[model samples]
Each structure stands twice: as C-alpha cells, then as structure tokens.
Target: MELRDISRRVGIAAGVVTVLALAAPYAVLSGGSYASQLADYYASGVVGGAGIALFALLSVVVVASVERGNLDPGTLAGAAVVLGVATTLSAAAWATAIEPSPMFRDNLWLVWHARVVVALSVLIPVAAAAYARELLA
Candidate 1:
C-alpha cells in the first residue's frame, strides 16, 4: 500500500466518523429529545459553524489527496493534523464529561462517539507518519 492510498483511506474514514459524531446524540432533555436532532440544533451556533467548516475542509482534503493516478502528500498530512486535533478534543471531552454524565450513562450515541474518536486518534498519527515518510523518501 502506498502512502497516498493509506492517507486517502484515513481521510475518508475521518470524514465519515465526523458525520457520525455530529448525528449522534449530544443532549437529552425532559419533554423533548434533543439528542436525536443534534445536527439541526448545532447548525445555528458558532460551534456548529466550525464543525461544518471542518467537515467541508476534510472532505475536500480527502478528495484531493487521492486524485487520478496522483497523490498529494502535503494535503494528506494536513488532513491528518486536522483529524488529530479533532480526535484529541473529542476523546478528552468524552473522558472528562460524557462518560461521567448521568444523562449519558446508557446513551448509545456517547458510545458511538467515543469509538469514533478512538479510531480517529489512531488513524491520524498513522496517516501523518506515512505521509512524512513518503515525503522524505
């Protein structure tokens, strides 16, 4: 497997995971189910805007990283860095807040988010290293 191929796969996976995280339940309230419509809720806020931008950038990077018989190592590396930051933030939040919250004790969305963050954390470093190696080679 080439560095480009590996990075392209990771980028795609990261984008998918981000989408899943956004769709996952963020909160649950009495008399209303906010968790089910996380994206709709977050879509109107500053944080939501950032998330949207991140997803857009990631999608572009992933698509650009894997072109017709060509590879963009720099773009792949950039994507890896973005994924790394996202993973760190998500994992830290999960460990410090989500897992300890009484409301999320039985939340499947929390579990899904946690799993995706872990996957992203692992993928980011591997993709970055591969891209770096390819560049050096």
Candidate 2:
C-alpha cells in the first residue's frame, strides 16, 4: 500500500461522504441531520455514523493492505485517530451546526452519541495523516 494508494482511497471516501452529506434530502430520523424522511434523531445519526465508519475503515484498510513497501502502518492508525476525532466533532456539529434543533436540546442520547462520534472523528484524520504524509510529504 503506497502512500499514494491510501491517499487516493481516502480522497474517494471523503468525496463520497461529502457529496452525500450535501446532496441528500436530510431525513433527520433521530438526532440532527435528515436523510430521506424524518427519522428519530438518534436513528438518523446512523447516516453520518456510516460515513465516519467508512473513514475509519479506510484508515484500517490502508494500514492492513499496504504495510510492506511504501505504506506505513502508523499512517493507518493516524487516519483512524483523525476519523475518531472527526466523528466526535461531527456529532457536535450536528447538535450545534447541522441540526441543533431546540427539540433535541433536552435529550440525553444525543450527548451520548458524542462518544462514538468523537471516536470516528479521531480515526479519519490520524489514518489519513498517517498515509497522506507519507504519500504527499
């Protein structure tokens, strides 16, 4: 897994997620952002959660797939870490930026959602950084 390969994958995944985030009808199933229909805020959060998971998975895969030649394992871990951080922040963004509806202000689960959210956030950056630095720098 050369740095370029991992970086490319990250770019693709990021691009896909970004596009989805922007192009959807935003269901708002559970927590904040809506997708198709208005789901529970918590359930709706799964959409973003999938994206976070994809980011983390990309880090993990890059690490696992291209460990021999030019790819560094640490890069993958770094990507995972960033993804985790991003996930956490994303949840906050939803609460504050994306959704932030007054209805969820009193909710408890939304706060709990932050835990996994943060984890995803941390994972992506660390993973991408791990590989991206190697690929780019």
Candidate 3:
C-alpha cells in the first residue's frame, strides 16, 4: 500500500487504542481501609473527565477524516495539527491543574496513575501529528 494509506490505517488503529485506554481502569486501589475513600475522591475530580472528553473529541476528529475521502491531504494535515495542538493544551492543563487529595500522598499508585493518564493524553497528539506528517508526505 501507499504511505498515505498505511499511515491512515495506523492512525485509525492508534485512535481506537487511545479511546480504549481512556475508558479502561487506569489504576485500581486495593488492600487498604482507605481504598474506597481514595477511589471516591479520585472519581470526584473533573479534570480527568475533561481530559478524557477532549481526547475522545480528538480521536473522533481523526477517525472522521477517513470518511471525508474528498478532503485534500493538506486539509487533513491541517485538521490533525490543529486538533493535536488543542489536545496537547488540554493534557497540559490536566497534568498541572489537578490537585491531588492529601490521602493520595500515601498511595503512590494513584500518582503513577495520574502520570500514566497524562502520558497517554500527550501521546494522542503525538500520534495525530505523526499521521499528519505522513499524510502530507
């Protein structure tokens, strides 16, 4: 297959994986009397939810581009770049703006989970940009 076609398929696969990752259980707290409380505290946050929504939106944009076969490569590239930038900004906000609960200090796993979420969030844009570059080439 041509580079463009290969890149498109890879992009779609990446988008699917990202969507699943966002939906999957990031970290499971267990074996502690405070685990339930920590889980509740984690679930009460909005930044993570916002980050997931933004990531989902970006994924939809990338996936939807495939349906618009008439769109030129340049246009697709531009869309991907723009959405990628927006996703990156959202991830940055999610990573820095979240205020972890004092309880989280005792549970380092939650910290790792947050870092993983931020990493995955950042990766979506990187994948989009890579796809865009390939499309342009």
Highest TM-score against the true fold, candidate: 3
Clashes of 2: 54
Better model by TM-score: candidate 1 vs candidate 3: 3
**Model 2 TM-score relative to the real fold:** 0.37
Q: Where does model 1 exceed 4 Å of error? A: 26-31, 34-79, 99-102, 105-112
lDDT of 2 by residue, 1-137 (tens): 77657654664465344434422323333434432223334334544545544544554454445545575555554554565455545544543433544444644444444444454344345545655566546
- Decide which is better by TM-score, 2 or 3: 3
Candidate 1 C-alpha lDDT tens digits along 93-114: 4433332344345554554554
Q: What lDDT is reached at residue 130 by model 1?
A: 61
Write down the lDDT of every candidate, Cα atoms only.
0.50, 0.47, 0.57
Locate the minimum summed-lDDT window of 10 residues in model 3. 22-31
Q: Which stretches of candidate 3 lie over 4 Å from their true place?
A: 1-6, 23-48, 102-107
RMSD of each: 5.6, 9.3, 4.3
lDDT of 1 at 113: 54
Weakest ten-residue segment in model 1 by summed lDDT? 94-103
Q: Summarize candidate 3's per-residue lDDT along 1-137 as a digit string, tens digits.
A: 76556655555555555455444433444447666554554354444544555654666565457448876756766676666566556555555655677556876665555456556556555656666776666
What TM-score does prediction 1 earn?
Answer: 0.51
